[model samples]
Target: MTFAIGIFDLFTYTISGSIYLAFLGYLVVRLHWVDIGALAGTPVPTLIVFVLLSYLLGYVAYPVGAVVNRVVPRRRERHPRQEFLRRVPTAQDRDYVQADPFLLLSALQLHDKDAAAEVTRLRASGLMLRNCAPPLALGFVAAIVELFLSRTPAMAAGCAVLLAVGFFSLIVQARRLSHWARMKTLELCFWLPDIDERYRVDRNAGGGSSPNNE
Candidate 1:
């Protein structure tokens, strides 16, 4: 059961991460490198394959990473739990599975809720906003306008209108990211282990024997 759930949880995490990476690429590539219009002419099947590849990469990246960990050994990791939370390359994340079989699944859901709430908080503060909203909404409206842009048509207007709207979302999302980053930092700080001998227990664990026994 843990194996099945871990696989599924890891896949979801990977896909989300992959999409994040792809979206980052889209922003840079569309802005400076590739012309979206030119790319649109590519064969549909190939495009579909490319998207599937993105999702597939996301789905397997973590599990493959975990499996790799099991298959290899290395210098012992310091702060392995933090490393796991950071989602970097690790030999395995079986530690979490071992700690609590349902932990991975719980983390996924909790992370989502925590992320959304953090974003909303930032939005209220005018720091971060959803970046794609404007462009997407404008594009939708443009499609309608373009059907009649010659009359009331906005064939290309959607893209331009959306560009402006999307900026607002970018601000909100930025704030959200910053807010969440701060929270994550705090959480890590809270969970960080302390090994100072000075802090070790000074009390006897009843090793002297109870007074009654004495």
Candidate 2:
């Protein structure tokens, strides 16, 4: 599971990084900083270099993802714990009300491995979507610049519109996936008898700690 998660992380980073690199490439070409025509002659070497740089750029773009998350704000609705408590009357009596939803989810994972895996997968996908938004936004800006620079303004304008739609869709889907993952976690805990029993016992025994109080 850990290895799989790591691979997913790499895949997400590579995709987002590639888009970011493309954005940079567009800017470079527009500015006449590098002649891509010459680079195209050595296609093999260029592809190899691009692949390597994309992976490296993936790491660099991670902080950009963090900034995107902050700007987008995951908690657009009530916190997951609050939502869970509202939905499940029994949960209101437990430490889950005050406990961080993420921590509580982690604790629930100890008792429900399969459901935990699904939650992990959902969150990973959401993260990828979130990270990709910035690069797409950059690409949209590049397209707008292209509109001004290119002889065919219509083509560039079309590309910009497509990118703009893609950027908006990615943000919307990312938020939905994140919310789904959280709600799924709470739902799984409520439905699974053994997991619910274990979680309730743990919280009642003072195993769960509230983040605010800490």
Candidate 3:
């Protein structure tokens, strides 16, 4: 069942990622990188292949971006730009952020310096992947538009308009993710980890016992 759900999730993301990639295609068309009329002469089957390829590329972007992030040296922000609810976050904020599995186990509970480092690396990688989506989306859109522009101008125009609207929504989602990644990094820095059973029991009844106990 879990495996099936994972498959479903991957398919959903692939299609969604591809749609966003269409935004990239839109930009390319607007920039005249590829003449739309030229695509009109291309065979219908080839155009279909182009559309599929764009989607595949967008889906691939996530892992590629993540890998690139691991290679890149990230600059630490001494302080994140966003204002917190308080100069010192309240217990509620701390609890909320620590609910994240990576922050909780990797940073707080273990307090292993290496774990903290890994968390930071993962966050940086995630940010890069999110940032890559829009540009890739635009690229995909441009290709589709160019391929169909001459043969199906109306269809091409409609796709462009629709994708343009969706692109705005994607931009909002990407920004939100960026903010979350920043706040998570800041939260990791401030939180103190206590893996004691007493503390865990008081905070969360379901919080598991120490691994050594098992």
Q: Pick the candidate with the highest TM-score.
A: 2
- Give the top-scoring candidate (lDDT): 2
Model 1 poorest ten-residue lDDT run: 205-214
Model 2: pairs clashing at backbone N, Cα or C within 3 Å = none
Candidate 1 regions exceeding 4 Å error are 1-50, 53-151, 154-163, 195-214
The clash tally of candidate 3 reads 13
For residues 6-103, write the lDDT of model 1, one tens digit per residue: 32233334344344446555656635776667766789777665656655554444343333323433334234245445664342432231232122
Error of 3 at 160 (Å): 1.2
Which ten residues in a row are the worst by lDDT in model 3?
1-10
Give one digit per residue, the lDDT tens place, for model 2 in 21-90: 8888877887889997977677676776777687778778877876766676444553667777777878
For candidate 1, give the lDDT of residue 40: 62
Q: Rank the candidates by lDDT, best first.
A: 2, 3, 1
Q: Return the TM-score for candidate 2, rounded to 2 decimals.
A: 0.72
TM-score of every prediction relative to native: 0.27, 0.72, 0.36
Q: Positional deviation of 106 in candidate 3, in angstroms? A: 4.4
Looking at model 2, residue 193 earns an lDDT score of: 51
The per-residue C-alpha lDDT of model 1 at residue 154 equals 58
